[model samples]
Target: MKDYMGYSIEGRTTAISTILNQYSSGITLMKQDSNGEFYPLKAKTTILPNGSKSYILTPCNQ
Candidate 1:
């Protein structure tokens, strides 16, 4: 596991639900690859079928 800005992250892929459950909304999420490079996930706020809120992360065009 690695710590980034006080957030404990484990594994290469993490579920968006896990992040939203932990940090709530309006928080930017960053992903670190095996090479130790940080990348921003283009987070889009979404509402689930149950009406819960979460974020969907996609690769940034840049």
Candidate 2:
């Protein structure tokens, strides 16, 4: 989420889409809070029961 908040991926291996999905609505993709700060969603792609990739949003945007 820190990387997303900064908008600078200095050392990022996970895809932006993945991170977004992991965080879900808890974190904003490009929206700012009342404090005018970006809390990026921490999303990731996981293997589904059907042998497919599915996005899983984490409990929090951490």
Candidate 3:
């Protein structure tokens, strides 16, 4: 596992429902598509500094 901004990265795949249940509050969930675009999954979200509720998904090609 790795650490990212105080959050632990398990580096494993899991169901989306499991993630939503774990972070049931104050969190915005997004999923990536085959076209490299991201869409919101959950309604509960946090407003970013730019006043946007969602962000662009940047994929790591490593």
What lDDT would each prediction earn against the true structure? 0.53, 0.49, 0.41
TM-score of each: 0.32, 0.35, 0.27
User: For residues 1-62, what per-residue lDDT tens digits would candidate 3 score against the true structure?
Assistant: 11212232322222332344456765555667899887655322356898865322223331
Query: Per-residue lDDT for 1-62 in model 1, tens only?
Result: 11321243422233553464457677656777888888766545678899976554465546
User: How far out, in Å, is residue 42 in model 3?
Assistant: 2.3
Model 1 spans > 4 angstroms off: 1-27, 44-56
Give the winner by TM-score.
Answer: 2
Global lDDT for candidate 1? 0.53
Q: How does residue 11 of candidate 1 score in lDDT? A: 23
Error of 1 at 62 (Å): 6.4
Candidate 2 TM-score, true structure as reference: 0.35
Clash number for candidate 2: 7
By lDDT rank, best first, the candidates go: 1, 2, 3
* RMSD (CA, angstroms), candidate 2: 9.4
Ranking by TM-score: 2, 1, 3
Each model's backbone clash number: 0, 7, 0
Worst 10 residues of 2 by lDDT: 5-14
Worst 10 residues of 1 by lDDT: 1-10
